[model samples]
Target: MKQMREKRQPADGRRKSILSQLKEAADPIKGNDLAEEMQVSRQIIVQDISLLKAEGQPIIATSQGYLLLKKAQSHTITRIVACNHTVSQTADELTRIVNCGVTVLNVTVEHPLYGEITRSLMIRNQSDVRKFVKNLEKTGASLLSSLTDGVHLHELEADTAENLELAVQALKQAGYLL
Candidate 1:
């Protein structure tokens, strides 16, 4: 992996290096930085990422950058809560949940034709919620709940069962949980 930092690696070498870097990263790594380090264009990095993902890599593109969603972490209590609300209530619902010291890991909604649709959020704080909401507005993208007419599910995580219960109670009080 150290050799990856020296200069532009060969084609095969670059892809291997990129994979190594992603696997070693504790946080998302920006494409531009990856490209610069590999002495390649951002577009090239994007293509490489696409190829990597197509090959079954659990790489997710977040607003911050690219993150590999590996399945090893601290054991936290996870709960899936059913929710029903209009798109306008998204931020409020997320804020309440996060304020209760929970991480909203993902959101899911059942689509009539497409089956279950889920989007990973990895939102741990109000700031993450704000950024997610802002990105939604900026991109003019519709929420998954929009497809299901305001019904969805959130997979929430908390370090303790108590915190998870607090988050669930808050969501219920806010009329976000079903």
Candidate 2:
């Protein structure tokens, strides 16, 4: 077996590089990948991410990986849709929204003890949807909506109001709107 390589970069320098990497990446960057690139352990990357977040970096951890949130364009439209559906309908709900050219930005559920808990999705297309569902299946993790009996909210964004309307209508037609 090969020995693990190590790089002795300072924590501050590593974090700056991490921020730069996230900014430059078009897609989310996995913490494991970041650790490998930085020659550090995944936990170190996680701690760095936490520190960055404490500094108000707008970083979000998605099912896919770590992403640095960007400001929405002036013309972008955003809306939050309340939805209730069984876990089985998750893929259908997400697919419908993405099919309408709306990006599923995140999901939020109200927890009895924790209040509002939101997670970033950043799902822009069917491929992202597939990966998201597959990861859930692969991990055997329950959806946050399960905590609220399949009731949750999705934050959606689109380039046009028409796209947002189409997505809302699709969810409504499916009896997912709450």
Candidate 3:
């Protein structure tokens, strides 16, 4: 009873530290790096993240690492656009959107069995786009869009409605928009 309470103290403290570290980070922090800093296994860090999420923390896992969702600015505009294209066009599609001064928030797809699946991208520029495309090729992993015949939706964010409109128009011109 008392022993169990004492044992949980350290873990609770570690979770608090993890939350603080995430909040302070300007970019997503990799679990491996967090594990090394905390002197714990990566699995332990994963478990901590799960616990934090279960507590209603706004933490998201991205291709690069884990990120804490920030509140959208009052002037920010977001739009979800449907797109269909081959896997090879992913880079081009993302590049076009970012080139229009929009951030690619995430990709969503509807699976027959899973219903709706979404993954955070948090891609803000060409560099992020390059890293995302490179990771896919390096891992030989299939894009979520592959499940639904290259059909997917992207949530895009920009500073103004015009920026969002421009991004959508770009996708439409590239024949990527559905």
How far is each candidate from the true structure, as Cα RMSD in Å?
A: 4.3, 2.0, 3.9
Question: Which stretch of 10 consecutive residues in model 3 shows the poorest summed lDDT?
Answer: 1-10
Q: Write the per-residue lDDT of candidate 3 for residues 1-178, one digit (tens) a residue.
A: 5764554437888899999999999888999998877777799999999999999999999999999998878999899999999999999999999999999999999999999999999999999999999999999999999999999999999999999999999999999999
- In model 1, pairs of residues that clash are none
Worst 10 residues of 2 by lDDT: 1-10
Per-prediction TM-score? 0.80, 0.94, 0.92
Q: Write the per-residue lDDT of candidate 2 for residues 1-178, one digit (tens) a residue.
A: 1344334478999999999999998899999999989888999999999999999999999999999988868999999999999989999999999999999999999999999999889999999999999999999999999999999999999999999999999999999999
Q: Rank the candidates by lDDT, best first.
A: 2, 3, 1
Cα lDDT tens digits for candidate 1, 1-178: 5665466677778888888998999767889999998888999999999988898989887765788888845778899999999888999999998998998888888888989888778788888888889988998998888888899999998888999999988888988878
Candidate 1 lDDT at 141 equals 91
Residue 158 lDDT in model 1?
A: 88
Better of 1 and 3 by TM-score: 3
Our model 2 lands, by Cα RMSD against the true structure, at 2.0
Cα shift from native, residue 118, model 1 (Å): 1.4
- For candidate 2, list the clashing residue pairs, or say none: none
